[model samples]
Target chain A: MTRSFVLAGALTLALAATAACGGGEEPAAADGRGPITLTDTQSHEEASRKIIDAWNAAHPDEKVTLDIQPKDADSQRQRLINNAQTKSDAMDVIMLDAVWTAEFAANRWVDELPADMVKADELLAPTLETAKYRGKLYAMPWLTGTGLLYYRKDLVEKPPTTWAEMKETCEEVLPKQEGMSCYAGLLDKYEGLTVSFAEAVQSAGGTVVDDSGTPTLETDAAKAGLNFLVDGLKAGLIPEEGITFKEDEVKNALQSGKVLFARSWASLYGTANASDSPVAGKVDVAPIPGLNGPGSGVLGGANLAISAFSKNKATARDFLAFFTSREQTKTWATINSTPVAHTVLYDDPDLVAKYPYLPSLKEGIIKAKARPVAVKYGDVTAAIQNAVYPALTGETTPDQALSGLQQQLAGLLKQ
Target chain B: MRRGARWFAALMISPTLLVLALVVIYPLLSAARESMYVRGEGLDADGFVIEGERFVGLANYAGLVGERFVNAFANTTVFTLATVALETVLGVAMALVMHGVLRGRGLVRASILIPWAVPTAISGLMWRWVFQADGVANAIIGEKILWTTEGVQAKLAVIIADTWKTAPFVGLLVLAGLQIIPTMVYEAAKVDGASAWQTFWRITLPLVKPALVVAVLFRILDALAMFDLPFVMIGRGKFSVETLSALVWDEATQLRYGPAAAYGIVLVAYIAAIVFVFVRLLGADLLADARSRKGQA
Candidate 1:
């Protein structure tokens, strides 16, 4: 009897194993003419729906279904990767964060797009650069943005173009105002910190990684950039709470009339100028301050990529082209107040008249640099956050932070 | 006849055993197999990164000796011990209060269970706002403290949030234990001139040992796998609050599935070892109860 029971157990185990490994049928391929799903985050759900509606109207035969993913970038990326890894044809087109292009392309989860899919010359240089993995184009640039210096125009005579001027203005003007802090940016220990750190390094005339994708954080320019933030925090020019500020917090700080300067995205312009905002009509935008002059900001935006496992790759590619087209991009920018990849729209007379910050935002985006393009970008960004967070919180000096970061990046990128 | 009965019993339980094997054993075995292989790294001849797995038996396990893994291990252990211990004491007190309250008993019980009812992620967000630098927590203390930033403060914030959310769960379980105790035992102790504290120690405690053991066991298991509380309360990758689950999640999300599965196996082994020790030591009564039930059957 016991032998029979053991035999039965073994039989069940074998059956279960077979059941587990049995689901590997290849997805059937399809031509470009069919219904396809677009998996994107809900941040721009309204605008995305409008764009999809426009596409569906223009081409009734090739219908597109909008599948809204999570609003959080990390969750959205995980969902896309999970779907691709499972070889699911659920998502034909995906909206990828600019930083995820390298990871998706390296893993062959995203199909490489043709170079002529979009007008490469008309798109901003930094935005176009984010779409490429190695030398091949993997995604098409969508909405793009950069960090802009938001300052209270009513309080300061003019926006500061240098870190020294910003500090001097903070020291002079801060004491006179009640409950006011100096400057705030995305300094929390997350992806935003990495972006801000890269911006700082680049603004001080140093790059996080060189052309060969090697760590170059040991330079004096990197040190000066790190010191810009470290010294600001130490001297109370950047408020103590700024160490914990993210994008929303920094934007709130400026809009509530609590901060003299805030380094945030261009979308904050619309909100800061809203009639309900306390600082409405009092705030103005400028290029982010640097050691000497206007500093470069880290490029921030999303891209459209066709999933490698998708059955309807043709339809996906066509939809990407349609969505990132100049006309749709302008509509997206106006409706969502998103910074567009089309460079000419930044200087469009009508757009500039409607949004005054577009000119300064264009300058920031023009000088912006993409974060390091690495196959293991997840590890790279985590290392940056780990290495830089301590310095911002007064646990380490700027010199130590940069050197430590150099070592961390070197180990991470050694491959 | 006896053999026939045994066969019938086996046949009756076969479906349950089959389901268990498919769901539990299968995934565990799959994760074990995955842990032995590492994904190919770097680019291939075509400039695309090499795809597919390469067999590197035990290398992923050995690679867990890094500082990040050690820190996560330490954080996980500390959070489990701290949160479980605090929750036990507070939960017991709440259960006692709930048992004794004659007036507004429903109100008291419901209020106590409210925190437990709210979803953990929601509570994490609510506590985040409260723990903000200029938030109500600082307003109450009248001193600016960066609770969300790195260091011990962030760890404390996580522990506090976890304890607040789960203590009521323990209370609910223990209250069930309290309700089952017969009033006759307390009366007998009273008749023997026992003090209130002495009665509680001798009668109430021993009678509730089985229920308490089960509750603590469940708590220990749950706390060891704590993820959402810390992940939501304190942001991810913060050195202060990273746990084993978070480490696994981080690795998996970064497409390092091999290392992630290895971490998962290590975490499972760690939990199993702790549970075994706990059952052998403090959970003797739990086993005794099971044995008695089987003997009766």
Candidate 2:
């Protein structure tokens, strides 16, 4: 029934494309209700507003507001979900994990981008695919991240380029440096384990699943990458203490200069290079290592979407476009250390001076890859983490452990 | 006039039924309907299967009966039963001491309730910190126990955190039960030449049995639906502490509404049946004994 009305509206719009807007005593107020407001859950809400304010100064007609609820990921998601379900339209824009965009798009819980908001081809080529369902965009890819190897430049002359090299380097350097472990493998039974594991697998040119989304961890290439994690646990190159580690734990280790190399999202740069960090002067970040293959990393990023249940579509889309604009992108990256997805942001000279590592880190952004962008992506990730975490902490063999996980995810997807 | 007052009494009780319908009844019905339907792409599974959702009959339940599902379910069942049993036993003992012939009763009672008053999430995080390599527990153990690393340790960590957070609640309940026992019953038992153990068995035990059973059963039911401690400690991704609640939350978050709803429905049934059976079978004799004693009182 809704589809017929939509089709009829589409037909009418096609006939009168330019004259679709109607002005009357009761309706159709212009100037888009005095610009748009987009709510973000990113930590850099103030910086975003400052940047948007500057843009508005140049173009005041395009006023946009950003609301950042930075503290809780779950509350943000639940608020967005409840709002959408209730048709409250509480948020004009939603900042969502990159993995979520596909699910959002699939549920039709979000609206497709307007014809002019963004060019499909012009967006981050690989990353844009994550925001689409059935080849239609529901979200705009904004900032992005991939696992990078953060090492101490003052302590280590050369960083490791492979799993083997990383272990050897850690053994050589960790003994001399009092607090440092060789590698900060997130042995912590958390989501980050899967994130790091995916990076290792993809860096080796391995597929976690086939096109149909079947898990096949019994593969030889899969274990080659899996062994790196298991071997690290056995060698004590990574700490047993790391099994209790979360993102904050590893971040604290890196910030305290207690770990030689840390595998983390590049977003860590903001915190690692901050004045509060003990190793701020010493840390440098590079790509995750590969063994006899081109390096790869799992994408850590988010996108902005207009909730389908939102009452205000124009405002949400405006916020989506405005925040994603190359100008604001540079401002966010410069101030907060969030890597801008827009390739052109790398050219900003002021941002470069603020973050000298931006140029070095661009390689990771250029090569950033996403996990399987399915509605079941979350389930797959959960299962994979469940499988890999045990092996990571030496609870089970890489084969026996992953064999179960491989079976589980495949079984789940099939169901 | 009296009949009108009885009618007014019924009207007053209706609010609770209205609340029950709104909160518990509606969600359960919707969830049950949602479980029967399969989610395809787009809005394929929106309303009831008859209305919009296509019913898949028992596929959802059958699918969840697999290895991962069974593993999580068995783990949850074992964890809940074990934790509930341990906490209740410990809580009852602690409560008896608080109400028993003991020194510093007020201080002990006050200190014991402190753990229960702490928020589950905060207490869970605190326990996580305590179990960390450099944290208090590891320091006490004199070895860096990887609390969040292994399945065994992770479960133990959750059990510890949960017991810390909830045992006080059980203790308070049992303590209330202990207070209800008449002083005359103990005096009579002493006059009968009863020892301390015999007094406890003959007088105190029977008197508090109902409250103790009620507390234990209540805790058992609550522990069945456990989420926070496990989630905070091991997280959802690691099935090391993945209980039914986390699994359902995970499925819902992932947009696997069918499986989530399916698991949710099954979990509700499991918890309700378990609680009901526990009270009906376990509480019957205790309830009868308490009632006869109350009649005597």
Candidate 3:
């Protein structure tokens, strides 16, 4: 009986293996062309799906499908890297964070765009710069984001132009408004912290790392920026919980009417203005406060790239161009509050009429700088985050933080 | 006849042995081998020499001694010890409660097991929401504690979530152990005029020791390698709650394959040493019942 049981088990296993093989490649399309799968983060999945649907309807011969990725950017990047390393054809079109361009290009995971396909003059210069690696375009800028200072319009008459003024204003206004904290910022020990630090340094008229990937944090401007955050947290102008806030947390604090001011991306504007928001009509946005003047924001956005291993590269590239075209991009920008990289959208009267803050937001996007692009960007950003986060948390002084950051970045680059 | 039986036994076990080698032994050996070689960023160049993989000896292992990895290892050890100890104690109490004569015993058993049946990730996210600054934790305490941001608070939050999700498993094991003890043994102790406390100490504790130890061992190993619960509860890059497994994951994501493998190798060795000490020195005989029962039969 036991021998028969073993024989039956072996036979079942063989049958199961053959059954699994039955699902292997079948003709999925009426035309010979296969479905083009575009993988992007879940944040913009709805907008991406709408565009994909439009594209599919226009060209039924080559259908495009949307694959929403993890909500966290880090996880999405890791998944893309894993797929590329394994030479998997699971992803055809990929949405890459602006900082991933150099690493993806260096790894030869993305196909280089045709020269004619890269219309540099039509897109924002800074946004377009992120899609290029070593003078060749490997990705297309889909959407653009820049940090903006959101304030309770009912409380503050006009937004503060400088960091010191903002602090004084918050101190003056917070105690008067019951149940209100002074400020909310994203100071978590992650990529958000890196973005915040870079914006701060740029707003202080200093560059954390120059275009050639040199650590420039030794400058006084960088020190000033770090000091602004450190001193704010120490003085309680920024709440202690600010050190733990990510974009969502900061938005929650603002929408819940807990903070007088918040520093966040352009995406939060729509959420805050939604009818259900506690302070929906009470909020207004302006350029982020700077040390000497209006703060320069950090350029935050994703770029679309075709996978080198994709069997449908032509369809992927066509989808990329169609998605970023002037008409489609305008439609996307209106539906989703995402700022587009196409310069024409910023000038469109209809867009400006719907979103009154579009002009100032456009200026902020223009002034913002991209994170340091390098082959070892992951290590570089980690080093920056480790150093700057402590300073913001009041564990170390700004001078010490910048020096430590400088040393760690140099070591990482050398490695 | 003995030689032929030995040959037949070996042939009978061959398939399982092959599967064990493929799934378990092969990966372990490959990780150990890969730990010695370093690969740089940004190339899929194949072969050991061609892909910039250089034989670096113990350098990769040495890299595992970084402050971050050390802190993660220390945190993992503390979490394992604390969670396992607490779970064992709680499990014993729970087993006693369930073993006693009580009304609605089925309902209590089913209700207690619901926490364990909930997926770890789902439970973790639920706990994360509860522990938020504006959430129930602060509401109950009325002190506005930053449960996820502070180091101690974050560790305690993870521990609470882990304990809530896993204590029921230990309780189940101990309950099974309790059920197996014959009623006549307790009756004899009662007839001998032994007090309830005396009977529990002399009869129940010693009899349940084997199952409790085995449960503790499994829990210790599991808690040490925990990743998903903490990852979901308190996001990443926090030195306070990052476990050794999470550290390995972080390193792997950064494309540091050799260092990640080294971490895996070290973690395996550490778990092995722990299990060895538990079974060999602590006298936790996991297979004692099977051997003794077979002998009796």
Candidate 4:
């Protein structure tokens, strides 16, 4: 047994050595600069692929070769962390969920793009706030999102503009049909929590964290917004199963027609509007339902950043500029059917025809807001999820949960 | 001949030691080195020293002596202790039934391994679905289980998921040990008018003590490092069911490398202390001695 272990260990060491020298760090340079590896898997493949094709065409000499690897969100993040810790120069450019920009910048894992590539404020009003940490442009916003109320138009007379109207419709329809429930945003604790909580908060005129990034959800408006969710769960207007839902479930609920109306990102509009959708043309989207104020929603999207360890920062910058530019961002929206950060995509008749709500989505982009821009934002966002999820599930009282959130954020900010 | 055999043995052992050095020793040393630092800006980029990047000594350790640290330490302790206890008891009972006192041992053993043989990720997904509000388990029980809502239920979900994947592993190990227990001893005890309970206490347990210890130690180490099942089962909330592994994940993924490295050091210390205590209680030579003593006798 000991001998076998020794032999196995020796073999492993030899294998590792071979892995390191043979191909561990392949020459990623495309323009005689360096390589840029990006995780563009599953649904986002065509978007990145289209960009790569366009970049290669435009910068024929610079020849930016991007290695697009398949990875889930969590795994992609783990890879990012592992790359950072190891200081591997295998990847140059990165695609980050917009929220991770501050976390990455605060930790110093990524570099700001050349200032000329983007006008920090002109890109998107809400993202400008999230894009900074102690006053530094850490990431360039790529795409943007805010929740839209996806409802079956043929089944319902009109898209719900108020929370009460939606609630009444759900109360009437859910029990009348089997496996049919009004799917709201995911009640499961994740970024989905932020999306759903924001719908309610913005509807009730509450913000979890204020303009200066101070904790604010403990206020009365926030409590009432959360109470709206809790009341839905208790009334069985939204099923109890939502308490454990992630993004896919909300989509599944809408695509299957089991849900009368759901609040989800504009990104899911593509899926809902697809021909395969059970309720394809029957579906129409609006901003989140509101009671006291205008309908507003939480914004979530991806951002592009240049990894600091990259030996090819110049090439990466050019590619980023092209990717987020007026022509390319518009082209990207036209081809991929996701919203465009460039306002040009909104008026493009082809895009508007394909997605009639391109105007609303574009408006949402211009107004997309983040939960908080605190250094401890992830922790604070997690506190919000923890507080709101239970209240929605009837496990924690709305007041109790929001108060806990207040205490948690106050403590984290102090830390 | 003896000298030549010893040289061959040492040569064989050297390869294993070299592999361990390359894989384990190298990473551990690097982690230790990385732990003694304070970094600013891009950790993977052109990270510079904000406070201290080198030789911070006990400051990193000092940071971990606070509430989150203590809570994580306590959570790991509770999770490990509870999981090990349950797995051991369940594994033994399961092994006994699978090994069988009568016919159809083959069928029993194969069927018993169904839960164990399934991949852990698959098992976690399976259990997660069952633990869902109106899932299979809920359908049978006729009540929604608020698994993710309540803290206690969340912990229960993690433990159930862990046990479904791990207990079979323990059962197989214990069963192998049980099979090795000379049947003659049990027969002799029976002939000498020993009750079944007495025979079990005297013969079955004492003989399998080494295996049982090994199983528990293996499980304890694993449970302490658990991340997937819990992370998959539920988001670790404000009243966290978050293990140290989850904390390390959340910190690292969220780009808190300096603090994450510090956390990594603390986790290493925690694991080391556990291994040290376990080895001391169970003895390093226990298994080797048990076999050698048997041979000599």
Best by DockQ: 1
Chain B TM-score for all candidates, comma-separated: 0.95, 0.86, 0.91, 0.84
TM-score of each prediction: 0.97, 0.83, 0.91, 0.81
lDDT of 1 by residue, A1-415 (tens): 6765776677778889888887878867665567899887777888888999999998798899999998788888889988987888888888888998988898888888888887888999889999998888999998789999999989999899998899889889988999898899999888999999999989998899988879999999999988888888888878899988998789888877779999998888888899898888999999999988889999999898998888878878888888989988787767787787999999988788888999899889999999998878888999899889999877888888888889989887766
All-Cα superposition RMSD per candidate? 1.7, 9.0, 4.8, 5.8
Candidate 2 Cα errors over 4 Å, as ranges: A1-37, A51-75, A114-116, A119-129, A132-136, A175-180, A207-221, A255-258, A273-276, A393-415, B1-12, B41-52, B100-106, B187-193, B285-297
**DockQ for each numbered candidate:** 0.66, 0.20, 0.24, 0.19
Judging by lDDT, tell me the better candidate of 2 and 4: 2
The residue pairs found clashing in candidate 1 are: none
Q: What is the lDDT, from 0 to 100, of the residue B156 in candidate 1?
A: 91
Candidate 3 chain B least-lDDT 10 residues: B41-50
Worst 10 residues of 1 chain B by lDDT: B40-49
Task: Score candidate 4 by TM-score against the native.
Answer: 0.81
- For candidate 4, the per-residue lDDT at A339 reads 61
Indicate the docking level reached by candidate 4: incorrect
| Segments of candidate 3 deviating more than 4 angstroms | A1-34, B1-5, B41-52, B289-297
Q: What's the lDDT for residue B11 in model 3?
A: 66
lDDT (Cα, tens digit) per residue for candidate 2, span A101-176: 7656655567778656776554556667666665677778886767778888888788777777876777787778
How would you encode candidate 2's per-residue C-alpha lDDT over B14-95 as one tens digit per residue?
5555555556666786788788777553334431112135678877787586776787798789888888988987897888
Give the C-alpha miss distance for residue A29 in model 3, angstroms.
22
